[model samples]
Target: MLEVADIFRAHGPTWRRTVSLSLGQLKVMSAIEQCRSAALGGHVLRCSGCARTEIAYNSCRNRHCPKCQGSAARRWLEARQADLLPVGYYHVVFTLPAAISAIAWHNKTVIYGLLFDIAAQTLRTIAADPRHLGAQIGATLVLHTWGSALTHHPHVHGIVPGGGLSSGGERWIACRPGFFLPVRVLSRLFRRRFLEALTDAHRRGQLQFFGEHAALADRATFAQWLAPLRTCEWFVYAKRPFAGPQAVLAYLSRYTHRVAISNQRLLAFDERGVTFRWKDYRATGRTRYKTMTLQASEFMRRFLLHVLPAGFHRIRHYGLLANPVRRDNLAKVRDLLHVAPRFDPPSDDTVIQAQPVFICRHCGAPMIVIDIVARTAPIRAPPMSRGAT
Candidate 1:
């Protein structure tokens, strides 16, 4: 299968020399090139029963690398499985208008953080209103900055429970089984709050401007630029509730760890350029699936567009799932629902295994690691003390 790594490995050195990139993008490119290669080292595996030998390389394990997120998504889902509630789960998306998306391309750290904060605030505020859901809702917000075609589209996906605890925390208030907050309501309020926050950032000089957008550095010019967005309807979409809690987790897994593009989507690469499948969201039916080919440099540029700001978190929790007290809040909610509270396993209850889990392909016998190769050091024999075992 063709991969983002293949493209990077083939064209990265030339691309890096030609383009100006952030430290984060440089690091991501380097990591993808070296990932699972001999440069990063590996382990030599010996089948316990079949006496077969095989070598497996290590991963770069960088968050942005397309090849490195499967285990991460699995581990994250395992931990989140415990947080599932008996109630329905709704998927809501809050998206910025194109003008804002343009600004966000340059001011990622500031603008993206604002998106998450304001989007969360919008959900909580609306859900708490007596005329709306009238409860305190919880949401796991995942920030996706790229559209299917790698355009600069910034949006937050909110996985919200169909209902929330009453403000008093005494009883659960359930949303209608298939519905959560109204999309129009969420859109209107999200637009207002986000514009307001963005204006404040501009006033405080938190926003930066360059190239075609250098005029935005002026408060007056920026305010005028933001005027149309304030009046236009913002895009907020809420999907029907998931079939069950497990379905919700499955859905979350798809979006939470997604990179700009996945290896499975790439179709071909050659002198003609890189060909990949993408969904043209504007179209309907079978025509929606389309393949796009971009020059190697353009492809790399698009991929790097999503390198998150250093230390910025793409996933965040809000309301009842707030980090400081989420565990206690979840326990309290379980008690109300008459479900058993989830407790951490007792230290002695679980056994730790250090054995290699891979099986020998030829004989179907479990494989054991006999030699560990370090990337920066010469190969060494196993210690006599451990080998004696």
Candidate 2:
């Protein structure tokens, strides 16, 4: 059983009584509790070699449920393998200034969308400049709203093909083997574009603030807040180029379908509270794994804060991979790279058939279910302790 199950089993009822009565948290609790358990159904497998039997429970398969992401990650990796191109890939991260995080929390849909737009536009615009790459770049951007400690830290992780087609489509602009775009320029352009969009949103009344950030509600106050942002160093960190296109797809496999936390990271749960390991960037030397204790209600609040609106996509494709012209552009790219178009055969393995389950937990030998545990009804209480009324 996962730590989340133990935590939920112990405190989940109290949380339902204290917090907003909603199905979301309940469903999450149910998924976490039933993960890797027969309650959600399973299979019985019998080994022929030794006549050993095993019972394996199925996973909830919920994206937000930590226990289910393992297989999801694997399946995603396999699918991405087909999209890999034989070219160098770049890892570019775009992060927003801290001040915007509050407003982003309130208007997640709008601001998150803006984050994607600005990042994509900044890259495409820079790459199109004749003095720079002067080409069209293809990339995938994934939005991550939480840091390791479950704080509201939003950023975009982009895996870009290092080289691209020239403006006239006559030649390719292959980036320097070790470099893609200059960080300084990318940072400047990214800051300018992002701030400009933010200012526009503020003017158009698309942003709202209250409580601690209420001062930002005033137009002049907001301008003052935005003024220092440009001078501040907006981070645009780029990792060394990946060996080739296969690496790009592989990198996406790790980040694209990821959730807030994973079962493996959970350490333990007890009567005091829940404890889990998280990365603390502030510390020096080896990054330390720290634990946090929270009341069940507080935990539920923090966890549910990350549930995105329905149908909002956290992963997006741009440039050559954009849906409208993906096939046509991919063909052109294959021709330019001198690689023959290879079609992937229909996959027979994607049909998630039931796995056989019939196994003994203590020994490898086959075991039969000889008994069933049934719930017993509560016994009627004898007349209440008679204190003469």
Candidate 3:
């Protein structure tokens, strides 16, 4: 299968010389290019049953690398398993308009942070309204910076429970069956809050502009630029409640650690260009599934456009699910809902078993590391023993 790593390995050096890229983007390219290759390192393992030896290379483990996100997502989901509740869950998405997306390209950390905060605030504020659900809700928001076509479409996917604890925290208040919250209300509030926050960010000089948007650096020009976005509708979509808690887990396993594009989506990478499957969401039915070919350089460019600022988290929890009080909040919620706690601490008498780190492919048996392969480089003499003369 054609992988993003293949494209990066083939074209990254030339592309690096031709176009200017940020240190983060350059690091991402290098990581993807060298991932699982001899450039890193590997381990020699011997199967106990078959007595077969094999070499396994290490992964890059960069969050932006397409080949590395599966294990990352699985680890994240394992940590989040206890956070699930015994109620329906809703899938909501808050998308920034194209204009904002353009600006976000330059001010990713500021704007992306605002998107997460404002989206979570909108959901919580609406759910707490007396006329609405009138309860305090929790949400897990995952930031996705690219659309199916590899366009810079910034959005947050929010997974919210169908209900919340009452304002007084005495009882559970579930939303109407089959529906969680009104999309129209969420959209209006999201638009207003986001623009207001954007204006504040501008006032504080937290936003930046370049090229055609350079004029937006000025206060007056920036305010004028944001005027239309205040009135126009912002897209906020709310899907029907998930079938059950298990369904929500399935959804999270797919979306949480996804990179720009997966290796499975690549169709061909030949002289014509890099060909890949993409969904044209504007169309309906079978037409939506289509293939797109872009020059290798362009494909790498689009893929790197999503490399997040160093240390900026793409997945976050807010409100009741906030890290500070998640355990207590979950306990309270379970009591109010009369459901058993999903996670129970093991008693002292319970034995904990650790799984083997590596398994043999040829036989169903555990493999043990026989030797470590250092990264390719000049060989160094082994250190002398403690008693060496």
**Residue lDDT tens for model 3, 10-33:** 877667767768778877877887
- Which order, best to worst by lDDT? 3, 1, 2
Question: Which digits, one per residue and each the tens of the lDDT, describe model 1 over residues 243-348?
Answer: 9987998898899999999999999999989999999989999999999999988889999899898789999999999999788888888888899844465588
lDDT winner, 1 or 3 = 3
Report the number of the highest-TM-score candidate: 3
Q: Which residue pairs overlap in candidate 1's backbone?
A: none
Tens digit per residue, CA lDDT, model 2, 216-296: 978999999889897999988899998766666667767887887666777666666666778887886665667777665
Q: What would the TM-score be for candidate 1 when compared with the true structure? A: 0.94
Which has the higher TM-score value, candidate number 1 or candidate number 3?
3
TM agreement with the true structure for every prediction? 0.94, 0.80, 0.95
How many clashes in each candidate? Answer: 0, 12, 0
Off by over 4 Å in 3: 377-389
Stretches off by above 4 angstroms in model 2 are 20-30, 33-59, 287-297, 342-389
- Best-matching candidate per lDDT: 3
